[model samples]
Target chain A: MAEAEQVKVLRFWASPWSFRVELALKLKGVPHEKVEEDLANKSPLLLASNPIHKKIPVLLHNGKAIPESLIILEYIDETWTDNPILPKAPHERGMARFWSRFIDDKCVGACWMSCWTEGETQQMFMEQARACLRILDDELGGRRFFGGESIGLVDISASFFALWLGVLQEVAGISLINGDEFPNLCRWIEGFVASDVVTECLPPRDKLLAVFQSKKQAILATKSMVY
Target chain B: MAEAEQVKVLRFWASPWSFRVELALKLKGVPHEKVEEDLANKSPLLLASNPIHKKIPVLLHNGKAIPESLIILEYIDETWTDNPILPKAPHERGMARFWSRFIDDKCVGACWMSCWTEGETQQMFMEQARACLRILDDELGGRRFFGGESIGLVDISASFFALWLGVLQEVAGISLINGDEFPNLCRWIEGFVASDVVTECLPPRDKLLAVFQSKKQAILATKSMVY
Candidate 1:
């Protein structure tokens, strides 16, 4: 009868952003092909699909490309009505969007910069990151997940913290999250990674560590060359 | 009979962020009370309503507060379900959200910083802002508005460019938008502000200029003191 709907994801394997799109598709049970890209030499398709940002992961649905992981996640949820990733009520949906934006605006950048920086700059970022984590911890409260029972928009938006941040901290030789300081967030991370869909989609931990370590070494090499 | 719905907006008159919320509500014909906040001394209601960011433009609907201008726009659209601000199709909605975010994440900071800084830093920011505007101009090619035929999400999200940016550029003695470079955007800005609803809600041009002029003077005063 009708041809199967064409769905594809333009992704880079090591990216948490790309991982978010994969995880969302799996959660929704949407069948899609994956086109891996060499980020250094980005594919024409990737460039064409997302000319504005020129970054992954873009969700290609029947030739229509939707870029930005958070936006893609919303698109996926809207397109496939099953396994709703956002809350049903309008107010709840508003809160979900707000928190997801917060994670992107405040938490991710601060936490990321904290790992990549040094001295007073790093300390400032570390403090900022901690403040963000404290707010998130308070928000998470006693819920099983940020989405409450099942992973939802905020959790998917926050996939970076669930895995990448930890790996990044290790690679950068710093510790931002621990049981003593952020028990709620640590527990949420453990439960989040252990989930079936997330576990399936996440890149292997050691491989991720190796990638970041090498990148860090390269940064050091570049610094020395400049000096 | 049940009491009528109470919709209120905690706002700062000069703030573009607050302006977006008020404009959206006006577009949808949603009646709302404005609770003006003094930036120097924020009210307890404002603080409690938006603890996470503690910023202006919080929407209070029947006592449920929604923070962040973009998020609130979505909420208003969902709850009221009339005079739709976003598009009908999923892909279009995704694009609208994408561009709105791009304006916030890239254009706003660069354009604002270009006005506030000088010398090498100002030049750097000005270039970044122009590059972003060029992309936007190309995207808008021949379309009457970003939403096409009517004001929608992107147009609303880009409210800054329509009014505030022009004023700030004049105050700072820099020219970013003109007939030659950004003809499409210039046209869009003219049409956008000329709209009845936008015209009604916009802060007085003279008042806006005076506020920015004073603020710029304060910044210069501080800089001179530091030097």
Candidate 2:
């Protein structure tokens, strides 16, 4: 008898959270099937796996379902120790968690809002995004990546900055960063996108743009109706 | 020459987050001094330790500071090893993080709102609170604690319900749960509060009542001005 097939990921193409787990698995050389979820009409498997949130990027490992991107990242790191995501030192691990969480809590939603709303609301979110970018740029501190020499947990956690934010900004007609404004982040994003694993797993830019373009139109239409 | 002491916590007395770290340290028996910060006028140490969030419950270990309660709990569990907060199993640890993040993201602020709001707003928040409590009750499912037979990370993460939620409900004159509605949660709270280490560190209910009462009054006053 052979060992059981171990891993599977339920994901949506355009979700950064979903992409986080996908990238982690790819980087770790974990062989797993990707089940693309239709967010508009969620699959039974996705719902059953994550009944609490009914959200995707749920990693099914050895018959257990693990949700939340950061938690999944930790699970992958712990389960497969080779090519570690988090640093071995407790303090460094703590800092990595701090920045990763900071991105999730502060930057991600604000980045979304920056791309969706209009007038004062959009401006406010843009400012929030710019402020977050400034902080992250400073945190990068001339390093090649958030984890210093190479991409690690913090870098993966902030991967949305490289792909999603740029696409969303273009689609929403908002400009939060420029090469001059966030030079360190600009350099980091270039290196992150250039990485083989990341480039392989990232959704194509054109497809991402098409999805967000439609989403933005829907948001603006809804806003107009409310006004 | 003597080696310097290792652990210190920058905390504010009334903060649930600060209480979380305190409880974890006490349970782990990691001896440390507590420096209470004035939240109104945050100290330079607090600001320096957690420059990004600038919030309390910053745990300083041998000159390195780890902010965020859940992160600090992980750090404590990793460093101390004895009286482990999280389970050793990968899947169990993943579930612990899932529920912990769920409570942090969903329950805490909504629980606060359920207490402070009035009329329909209060009613809506109370419904949200009840829904969360229901999920938590089902999750508890006859276990003595969220971590099962012993107090663990999930149990500690939810320690708020034992102390603060009861206080807040009393202060706001709203009842989200009765014994009949959420038997597991009621039992869990009683057990949690009665535990030796929890009882030892928990702030006196009367003092907690005083603080929340004033805070509730302020909220109502602000609402009046807006209206």
| Stretches > 4 Å off in candidate 1 | A219-227, B220-227
TM-score of chain B of 1: 0.95
DockQ values of all predictions = 0.93, 0.89
* Candidate 1 per-residue lDDT over residues A84-110, each given as its tens digit: 999999999999999998998899888
What's the number of clashes in each of the models? 0, 0
lDDT of 2 by residue, B176-213 (tens): 76789999999999999999999888889998888878
* Deviation (Å) of A77 in candidate 1: 0.7
Q: Supply the TM-score for candidate 2.
A: 0.96
> Which 10 residues in a row give candidate 1 chain B its minimum summed lDDT?
B218-227
Candidate 2 chain A, run of 10 with poorest lDDT: A218-227
Error of 1 at B187 (Å): 1.1
The residue-by-residue lDDT of candidate 1 on B100-121, one tens digit each, is 9999899988888888789999
